[model samples]
Target: MKEIRQQKKQPEVIRKRILEQATILVSQKGISGVSIQNIATAVGITKGGVFHHFPNKKNLIEEMFNQIILDLDQTVEYLIKRDQTEYGKFTRAYIHSSFIHQIDGVVSAWSALSMTMITEPTFNKIWMEWLKNRLSQHAETDSHPDLELLRLAADGLWLQSITGVIDDEQCSKLEDDLLNRTYLT
Candidate 1:
């Protein structure tokens, strides 16, 4: 009975540690390089312990992606409360929150997972459908052509920033321009 109780508690403890370490590693390095052994070492645990909780790398990746989706959903909620217009909410939330500092490993994990999704048929379908639904929610049919152009520009800037292709200054400038076009102007 005592051994069984300890074993049950051990899995939760190991999983928490693995996730914390994995999040840091993924944010710092991106997903391609993260490994069960590496996460285990980072957490000062054994590979078997990591596997006990995750079973495989795919599960870990999925968990991380799910967390990201949850974070994005929370951000959307915050934006909805702060801004009345759909464009304003999206612009403000995307520009301000998307590029916040995270572990290099976590960022790398996200990048690798994203690349995988690009080629995987099921993931690609789901991602495209999600994007379409999200875009539809904010897209306006009667906006000026210039406003539409600006929205695309903002999206490009956000994508670049998320991929680590743009520096903070450039991202800030893009955010300011997006805010100006979407609200001030």
Candidate 2:
């Protein structure tokens, strides 16, 4: 029974490795520069193995996008729970997750994957749906104009950080400014 469980777990391990390697590759080369062959080579698996898990490159990308959204949602939820004030809990969480949060001491995958996914029409729909859902869920606490502006400013910082246009000091200051604004009446 233990051996059977190990055998079942092995495939899952490979699948996760493929996703990790794919994210690393995307961070380095952008989506257009990476392919199934590249991912398979990085993961030490065959093309067929990747197909066995993800069917096609688009499928893999979609999975990656879904994972990023899930991670962001979890982070926002955690931050919201930790916040003492209700005025801008959601917007504050959004700004904090976008700006200060890191995964495993590196920038979150959202910074890299988003730049590529943002250009895809389907991916845009996915992102919009996520934003709409989160906004509606937090309508009571985060509906103020200042909070909206803060969220938008956070988005600008997100773009700048991903593009390397903003230095760390500037980004931190802007992030703090945005977070503080979220509390305005």
Candidate 3:
């Protein structure tokens, strides 16, 4: 019985360690470049140990994407609590927070996954479904027609910032304009 209990706990411990190391590697090297051995070394474990938790690289990438989804959900909830209006909440949370920089690692992971999915239809469907679900929440049926456009614009700005195409001052101005167009009018 004790052996079984220990076995059950082992997976959780291994998974936690993998996630921690994976997050760091993804952040520093981006997803395409991160290797199982790199993660294992970072966590002081063997490659087989990392594989024990996640059977393959794709599984690890998917888990990282799931974490990003969860993080976004939590941030949305936080925004909802602060602002009663959906548009207000979304705009404020998206524009003001450093989500672009904060989620860069996850974004990089997704980018890599996206490239692979181009040839694999199954993965593409799942990825789109996940994205639609996340967007749909903020785009509840009652939301204004412009809500989708606003969301797209915010996403573009975020992408730009992450790619180093936009400066801090530019982001600030863009945020102001987005707020004005979205709510101030």
Candidate 4:
């Protein structure tokens, strides 16, 4: 039973490693520069081994996106649940989640890579669909003009931070300001 459990765990471990390496490579080299062979080489696995888990580069990108979305969803859900007020709850969670992903070392790499991925046509669509669904779900509470402005501001701040146009100190202040704005809405 232990041996069988190890066998089951190994594939999952490799798949995760592939996604990690792919994120790093894509962030450093841009989307066009990374390939299945590049990911395999980084993971110290054969091309066929990477292919065994991901049939192509697109599949790998999509899987990476899925993982990112899942993380964001969980973070937002947790933050929303902890909040007592319904007003602007989703927008507050979004701003907090954005800053968390940006500053938190665990997901900082993904922050940079996600900016790149969002530019890709397919990934862009996937991201937009996710945003649309989330917004629709929270329309009753998050549809206010003030909340919408705060959300857009948070997005702009996120873009500025990733592009190096906004320094860490300034970003923190702006993030705090946005969170405070959510309370007013």
Candidate 5:
């Protein structure tokens, strides 16, 4: 009965499930490796059902990228609002978002986002615009090279975790190092 109830969800709820399953599939295999059939199978839906949500693979990828950016923005906002100190908020925000997102599977869909960023104009534009805006947001740290380095720490940790170069233990330790060195003190 529970399984029947679960399978009888609305189209929109099922669509969200498809997107999440697609993201997990994308994380394991690059964009090219994920087919509509794979997403449908993961979501326990028909290929036609998947297409009902996303017209095609490119459209799915585009939606995934946008969802990633939205999630990142929310993470940053959460960290900034928590600190309320106005000092090193950007650094903490970046570190926190990167570490949490990586560990908590929020960025699973973005494992190979670089390919999208480099090959897709809209992805590149939105990413660059976000970076530029974030830089401006931390005006106080604009002249400080350490802040710049902190940004790299976030990116490096993200890549290392996403690419499976480091285990979770090492990733957590590195995340701690970035926090202790940058803001936690």
Candidate 6:
């Protein structure tokens, strides 16, 4: 029984390693630049071993996106758990979370890789759904343009950071100033 438990962990560990390596590769090279062999080589696994975890590159990309969505959900949950009763607090929390991800050792890779994935049609549905859900949650009686704008601003900041147009420190200050001006009383 113990051996079985330990064996089960091996596959999970390998899968996670593959995903992490994939993220790094995807960030360094665009999604179009990654291949199964590249991911396998990075993870120190055989190409067949990579296929054992993901049947194809497309499958691997989809799984990568799924993992990103899970990370995003965690971020949203963290934001919701904070002081969010104010009208614009949710929006501010969201921008704050974006900065957190950029600086978070565990999540920074995802944030970086996500900028690449964001342009892919395969990942569009996942992101659109998330955006719609969040907007709905904070929509009040009518749609809130201010809240949506904050969300867009956060996305812009993340993209700028990922693309090296701005560093995290600059992005943080910009986000802070945006939040300070935009947060409703």
Highest lDDT among the candidates is held by which one? 2
Best by TM-score: 2
Residues 1-185, candidate 2: write the lDDT tens digits: 35454434588889887877777666657677779999999788899999999989988877877877887899899999999999999999999998754545565576645755644656788888999999999999998887888888888898897788998888888888888888779
TM-score of 2: 0.86
Candidate 6: segments with Cα more than 4 A from true spot: 1-9, 102-119, 141-143
Q: Can you write out model 1's per-residue Cα lDDT over 27-83, one digit (the tens) per residue?
A: 556566678999988888889888878879878867766665556657655765787
lDDT of 5 by residue, 1-185 (tens): 35454445598878778777766766666676788988888788899998998898888888877777788888888888888666577787878776665423555534645656644556788888887898787878433677678778778887887678998899888888877666532
Error of 6 at 59 (Å): 0.6
TM-score of each: 0.66, 0.86, 0.67, 0.85, 0.82, 0.81
Model 2 clashing residue pairs (backbone): none
Among all windows of 10 consecutive residues in model 6, the one with the lowest summed lDDT is 101-110
Tell me the number of clashing residue pairs for each predicted model: 20, 0, 0, 0, 0, 0
lDDT of 6 at 34: 84
Per-residue C-alpha lDDT of model 4 across residues 1-185, encoded as one tens digit per residue: 35454434488889888988776666666677788888898788899999999888888877876877777888899999999989999999998888786322544544644655655766777777888899999999999999988988988898798779999899999999899888884
Per-residue lDDT tens digits for candidate 3, residues 1-185, read: 35454434567767876876676566556567789999888777899988888889879867865665466557656766787555555555544443443533444433333334543345567667865765566654325656557656876776686569999789878867775666642
lDDT for model 1? 0.62
lDDT of 5: 0.74
**What is the RMSD, in Å, between candidate 3 and the native fold over all Cα?**
5.7
lDDT of each: 0.62, 0.81, 0.63, 0.80, 0.74, 0.72
Q: State the local distance difference test value for candidate 4.
A: 0.80
Winner of 1 and 2 under lDDT: 2
- Candidate 5 lDDT at 113 equals 57
Show the lowest summed lDDT stretch of 10 residues, model 1.
Answer: 101-110
